[model samples]
Target: MLKPEDFRRSIVHEPGEFLAILERRLRAAGSSGRAGPRARLLEKLSTCYQLVDGELSKAEAFLKKIVEQGGFYAELFKLEAGVEPGEVLKRVKALRRAAGNIYASSRSELKSARGERDAREAFRAGVGRLVSIYRRNRKTLSAVRRVALEFSRMPDVEGDLRVIIAGMPQAGKSTLISRLTNAKPEIGFYPFTTKNIIAGHLPVEPYGRIVLIDTPGILDRPMRERNPVEHRAVLAVKHLADALLFLIDPSPGKYYSLDEQLNVYRTVQNMLQGKPLKIVLNKADATPPGELEEACERVRREAGVEPLVISALTGLNLDALKNWLTGLLKTGTRGF
Candidate 1:
């Protein structure tokens, strides 16, 4: 249940901005105290060291926490941003080392200072060195920021029972989730409408709660061939699924043919790794009887399971679907 919101709020500053802010704060502090010039210079240098050290330490800790809690957020950054958490952690450690070196050099320079002017010069030199280090690793910090933003947008799915609703594009996965839980994902006629992972909770009587997650449309293709939206679905299924509801659109004018839908289902099936799965034939209210029957037969013959026929649009057989899910929660079997 490690989620994006669980991460500490970190604001990444650009190299120049970070340097400028530190210098500005130091100057303001240096001008205020009534101590001798040397004492004030020492105060400014100490303040500068604290500022740089604190920023780097907090950032390193944040990255460490994310890597330690490797779950949905870590996989998500890998899939979308191509930024590995370990690599980012290494970069942060590198920056910390550079800052430590600069601070050490500054301390040595101050110890040998002949006058106030020498201390002032050493302080400026230290600030300049830190700025140079940050500038050299700008791309690394940018990647870190991108990962942080993506994590912030991820949906929180902390629950005992997580059921992922997955299918081809234009399948009624979003509508079905809205029907079952309080999550009202944007419903649309076009493909790939549900672009993000949406989580909704259903609190049942006697049993506790079920977290239903609606994922983006997954195409019938290999993992390498999937787009980011499709990868979102895969990540949810791979990491968060306790049970899965693979929806199939059986309408004559369905967005994808039953075969293609089944292919996507097979792809997800492999990702399930033994999680209970249910094949649902959606759009029964719109599908002709022949198409529905053919869809069910194909699922049984090919996918080796009885497809639960339900009209997510008309609320048909939804009670049966709910009953099946609640039964899973009750018995903890979640058997298909």
Candidate 2:
């Protein structure tokens, strides 16, 4: 048998199951994702996956690639929906147009801010109002961006990322999210605590400036089913997030055991649809160093991705995680 370490180092591609499913569905529908609704939907899904998986940096690449592929995804989407993705296509085009506007406007405003427009109290007030303006005009703001990131695009109404944090209810999600960011999802030792999505921002000094998002935790099914709140959190991540933070604890049932929480990991592994993914090994403080290392090795062998080993309670490795995540901001390439 392949040793855990051996498997960990092996080069296995992260299977694009989600994309394949969408492709297959499109084929069944006989539409193919050809530059229409089918195409736009696939692009949207790919962008969403990138955001949820802590891989937003890769999103534009995926979009650009799809576009270059001459509407492969568009055909696929059309194939799946069995309808002209005309409406979806229009929305996508409009979103792209809006992205250009935001960038242009930001450049002008950013320049004014630097050129003394910011010297006056009015400018200061304007800057202060950006957040609220962002909150109030969030729908329009999100409307301009191709990929969803901030709260403006969030379902139900305009809100912040704290909305996402409150949604994660797993044992360590709140603790970790609150510790790393300001969203504060109500930390607790017990399960089923966070009943909604709480969002927070991780300050980044990337070179000098950047932003990282901390999302709610996700525990696999079964236990999640036991708590209706958790199920909603999972669904919300699927629908709203640009990426996901999936946490697994083997002995999560008791909190101190070393059981390899394969169930939750497996559940997410299958549901993942070419989305960028981040695996988190929370409670690293609770386990022995060697045990945590071994657990990580085992997961790497199976999951084929590196994990963020952390102790939310003591803040161990949290800084590193934040820095690492901040490096994945996809701001400049927003519209592709």
lDDT of each: 0.83, 0.44
lDDT of 1: 0.83
Which runs in model 1 stand beyond 4 Å of their true positions? 16-20, 333-336
Candidate 2 lDDT over 76-180, as tens digits, reads 323333333344344444544444444344434444453343423332332233223234433332322322221122223122221122212344766776676
C-alpha RMSD values across all candidates: 2.3, 22.3
TM-score of each: 0.91, 0.44
- The alpha-carbon lDDT assigned to residue 177 of candidate 1 equals 95
Root-mean-square deviation of Cα positions for candidate 2 versus the true structure, in angstroms: 22.3
- What's model 1's lDDT at 55? 67
Candidate 2 lands at a TM-score of: 0.44
lDDT of 1 at 127: 66
How displaced is residue 106 in candidate 2, in Å? 55
